[model samples]
Target: MNLKATLEQWRMFKAVVEAGGFNQAAEQVHKSQSSIHHAVQKLESALGLTLFFNEGRRVTLTEAGELMYRRACYLLDEAHKVESVANSLKSGVETYLRIAVDIIFPPEMLYKALNKVSQDYPLLRIELMETVLNGANTLLKEGEVDLGISPFPLNSGFSEDLCEIDFIAVAHPSHPLHALNRVLTLEDLKGHRQIVVRDSSTERKAESGWLGADQRWTVSHVRTSIDIIRQGLGFAWLPLAIIRNELETGVLKPLPLEQGGLRKALLFLCFADGDRLGPAARAFLGELRYQTMSLPSVESIAE
Candidate 1:
């Protein structure tokens, strides 16, 4: 059978539906209207069906044409999938990598890496999705994400530990909680306001993490929560890496809690144990591992 002719007629049919007329489709597809008409006529003849009901200049698809149009879309979609697979094979790399991560890594880091890698490996592509511990792990289990950077322990047995980060709480310079040289207690934080990250689905929400917490406000992003705290709005819990400068400049002061600061490990997750990392992913992970180790410890909270 002449598959090429059938495919050409299928595409022309789609074009005509999209353009709303044969003349417009001809202009868009760079084909004469007569050529398009001839192809469709041949297609109908070969298939033993009526495709169009011609009335003067306006053309409408017959019942058979409408049914064929639907199937044609699926056929074209499959063709594009084939093309994508061929390109991926020719490029000698995987087609896609979907990574879901905790909101820890800033977009700047990923954007910078993309810019650098795209120069050398044009086919390399990375997509970033943000989720908390539960959501991130779910995507990894469902095979939605090629990887996930999570804080949750991987019971799925398909993950590896990336690195651990210390969580620290900080208060504004003028807040009452900062005036106490003694370690901050729940009672000490009771009267004061606090800014906290409220994990939610639709929007990043903020609420007090401490109840016996406080009357403080909540914010979604660490940057904004830290900003408000620096302005003396309230105290907040955040990674020390995010607030290093403010600590040094005396804009924000540590709460001096007697208990050790919260310690959370950042983990890398994949679908199977001993999964081999891709080259681009490996490079990024190498730099991240080095950077994570070099981070200043909580001892620098006084700085």
Candidate 2:
């Protein structure tokens, strides 16, 4: 089984589509325009299908080329991942580890786990993606991060019960809602502003619960939402871990909702490529599991 086209040729073909034309693609790949053209031509000949057509002063994908371009993109991405795996293997104990941890996962716990892992690999470089909602899962699916701690249940990949986060509806003690001095209903919040956090996933944006209120304020970070609520600007359901200080200090008070005052989500440890677990990734995983050994989980939430 001899493949006529090479990964280099496919990369140049993808470059042309992404860069908008061969001239730009040439500049991007740091190669001559003729070389870029030759590579695309070779790819077309090998595949026996025209991938692009020259129109007036612009180059565009042919009907068949559109499909091939998509296929080529997948091929190139997988090839890049293969190289990444190889690099990890060649250099034992990966020098860099990309991690995505949902903000709800207790920042203090996360920092402790990271510190524990760093003790063994002092030179490890870590890229921490503090995501909200579906953000961690998005990065894992896109191969952007090696591992993640997410609240969303995984559709694929290896996952284990990490911990449970309690979300409570709270507002500033001075807010108008507390003036009622009685149990509140969903309808009671209709006229008040609800501070909501934006889902971090650009690929698959989703909503968890919508409290149909007259006013809504969407913020990117939980800290921002909490800050707003602390000022009596609005009310929000914030993670107990993050707002514990505020709640204890009486800066934020719980809203007496009719029911479901406490919302609990079980977070999971996610591994993008669990099959090829690198030493650095495995170390982080172990540290996380070790730290969460006594934390509350689904069973505790039920009780």
The number of the candidate with the highest lDDT is: 2
Q: All candidates' lDDT scores?
A: 0.67, 0.84
Per-residue lDDT tens digits for candidate 1, residues 144-201, read 6666776665566566676665667777878877677677776677687777665533
Worst 10 residues of 1 by lDDT: 200-209
Q: How much is the lDDT of residue 165 in candidate 2?
A: 82
Q: Of the candidates shown, which would achieve the greatest TM-score relative to the real structure?
A: 2
Residue by residue across 204-284, what tens digits does model 2's lDDT show?
Answer: 775544487899988888888888998899988888777777776789998999987778888988875664568877888
lDDT of 1 at 65: 83
Name the lDDT of candidate 2.
Answer: 0.84
In angstroms, what RMSD does candidate 1 have relative to the true structure? 8.8
TM-score of each: 0.58, 0.82
What TM-score quantifies how close candidate 2 is to the native fold? Answer: 0.82
